[model samples]
Target chain A: MKTKKHENHTYIIESEDMERKNEMLLQYIKEKVNQLLQIMGTKPLRDEELNDESLIAIDPIGIIAESFEQVLDHLKESNRQLQLARDYLQAVFDTAGVGISIIDRDLKIIKCNEKQKELLVNGVSQIEGRHCYEVYCGIDSPPLICPAIETLEMERAVFLKEVTKKGKVFQIVTSPLRDRSGSISGVIEVSMDITEKKRALEAMCQSEKLAAVGQLAAGIAHELNNPLGNILGYAKLLLMEQDTTEFQKNRLEVIIEQAKRGSSIIKGLLEFSHQKMPVFERISLNACIELALRSLSDEIRSNNIEILTGLGTVPYVMADPKQMEQVIYNILLNAIQALEGKGGIVEIKSEALNGSVEVTIKDNGPGIPKEHLSRIFEPFFTTKPVGKGTGLGLSICAEILKKHSSNICVESEVGKGTKFSFRIMGGVTGNV
Target chain B: MADKSGINLDVINLDIRGQICPACLLISLKEINKHKGLLRDGEANLIVKTDHRDATRTIPDAAIAMGYAVFVEKKKGYYEITVGRKDEDQKA
Candidate 1:
């Protein structure tokens, strides 16, 4: 019996030693797992590590069980945070107003936001893994001035580029997307449609020009009126003299004619001096063009310039007849002057569109220079020499059309003819 | 009436004060021309004061060319030119 009791005590001591060793092994595994989790910046693995073939072969069963439970709790907490972060990022990308796109180093689009998807409807699903130029610009290769490739190569944010696609203007900015070690992995492109901003800027410029004209009108008119009054006074006084011979009467008539010419010039100056409030009416565009042509008929015929009319049968537009006349007249006069006595064809075409009317005035005169075409409608910008042009004709026409909720656009190629097309809203009824 | 009082109107009193130079006298003459009728009438007299003595000679010559009579008077070290009507009866 003494031998049996001693044997049982030995067994109990051995079992306690085994249990203590198992607890130490478990503590060591938990510490190692915590350290690894911190280093890897990943969620803690649960029974996965214990079940792993390499770990299971080295660790005891009891220690593996305890370490598994602790790791499971940590993994659950980490997973919850990761899910929250992922949801927040997805929400931001889904609802952002600016179109966002991610492209690889090869310029292939890897990811994109909802706005980007909205902008590209055709082949949008197939856009992924495709080159950005092929997908967005509908080109076989990237453009020469691509902002995305620049951002990647330079490894920094690049300036915004204005791009016109499908008649809509967009301001696109690109930045390099870096990896964990700050190495350039790809490019992040953001495109904002700035068409409205561009239109607003143009409108602001027009208003400023109008303000300047208003302030200078009084002074210019006063200066012009003095000379005009002198001419008219002397001409009338000569006409009223009774001793005027036939030869003298002819000279007097010439003086009167010259005075009237001066008066007309003053009228033009005065017209530019005031703030013009355009009156809108449902008027025929053909009549407007005819009146414009009539005003310039003598000049056109004298210059031997042929006028070609392609007036389309169109409905009348709700427009100010007088202002529209001015618009047409200004363009016609410019065309005549551009001919420079070496007459060319002036072709006028009018077409009624779905929501607007398009009037195109084309001249085969010496086309505007490439650099000057963009600033043709800018106030006080003229290619003509001093005393021959005021440089305000096209600008005034642009201002008038803009007041009527219209716009003037010019397309010209140097050495080729220039075309000026303007559109006016067809249904608008109120005066501007 | 011409010989009633033996007071010969040999010289007229013209005060041209606050005139700095010939340019200032010209500016003053322009302002005076704006009130041509008033100057033509004897009811008002031109009193021009100038800091420079040379303006006294220039103002009188300019006034005469514009058909006005002028006389210079020096007071308190300042030159004055009085511009009067060409004729007293011509006042309107």
Candidate 2:
């Protein structure tokens, strides 16, 4: 007999270890035979050579080993599934368009996704483990009314709110991250960039205010028309009476001139506030522009401002022909005024782009200052001196364009030039 | 002919202070038209007391159109508008 120890396990086998492979098989058979002897309904059988071709009875040890293997396989499958779920959640967090961040009760960021990093840091630095205020507001401390703090204190979710920080607008929604027992542990903050939306809302509000003022102007103008008309009529009548003295005649002349001025002012007011129900028809934009220019032909000629047109074959737009002509006339007049008699080129261009007909009026003159651009559409807001302009021309243009479901946008640079562009959606069927 | 002086006694005065536009002008015009016969005869003058600034313009303009000479005097708290027909001023 030979004995050997390897890897802390003792092996008893035939001297040639390869020939003793069936030693465990013999032990398995012995255990089975002993079990059969204990059962009253079984008959004991003699043991013979146990070869690969011979079938051995099922053993208790073999059953235990098979069960153990199945349990291990199930654990591996569960681990693989759990790993897949984690990867899927991570992908969603990273690719979400809105900014998302997780912060601890200390207001320190624990985790943040790509959009959060881009919005807060402008893609400059990784923001994890830093203070939330420093990343978001560029401040040392969070404001007292911070939504994250509010959520933590209330232990509930906070609704989305618009917040302006660092000259940008964000819509913030905060929720309390709680433990299993419902105790708040941290906060999850989601934010979306809303600066453009905020600007549009402000523009809409300004338009509404201008509309109200325009309506008031129209009402006042209508009321004054009667008295103003009477004044002019009577002044003319008095002047025609062949009065005795020239003094009365001079007074009458003055009265007549002032009354005419008042009438013109009323005319401007009516133009600004008049909201006629639009009679929609497909009209040629190029024809309207040419007509508006023809009406201002005298001013254009006297001022020596060149009228250049690039009227491409644009499809007709759905609009009231009369009102749309007014819009074109106002823009062209504005361009001429910007020239200020310096004799520059006023270029008009119309084309079809992206399912809309766009008309652009460009002037090579002293451009409007940047600050005044935003308020140019407001009624009575003017750069012209008193008695020169009623300041309602552009506003009336805006009102008409708004009725057509369009908007006017201006781009200008001081000392360079200015361009005003408006788009009217093209009508279906291409022509009337 | 014009009376550059001011409103004196013997003129019919209608006070319209605290009344807002259009309304003030309406009432003032009504009074002036009521005295049309006397005004044409050079026997009566019409004066209106109104605080509405717009009435100062509207009333005078309306009166002048009806063959009357109008004068506006801005007082301490309101405007005093006096109107007389051209014939009355000529007689005075």
* CAPRI verdict (incorrect, acceptable, medium, high) for model 1: incorrect
- CA deviation > 4 Å runs, candidate 1: A1-63, A69-81, A103-109, A117-156, A161-178, A182-186, A228-269, A278-289, A309-324, A348-375, A385-387, A402-432, B1-92
| DockQ (Cα-based) for each candidate | 0.00, 0.00
User: By DockQ thresholds, what CAPRI class is model 2?
Assistant: incorrect
Q: Write one digit per residue (lDDT tens) for candidate 2, span B1-92.
A: 01122335657778878766544554565565555667656677887888878788777665654556788899999999877756533532
Q: Evaluated with lDDT, which candidate comes out highest?
A: 2
Worst 10 residues of 1 chain A by lDDT: A58-67
Tens-place lDDT digits, model 1, residues A5-110: 4688877777778889887886677567545433322233445444345244433333323333433544675689799999999899879998899999999889
Q: Candidate 1 — number of clashing residue pairs?
A: 17
Every model's Cα RMSD, please?
A: 39.1, 42.7
Error of 1 at A156 (Å): 4.5
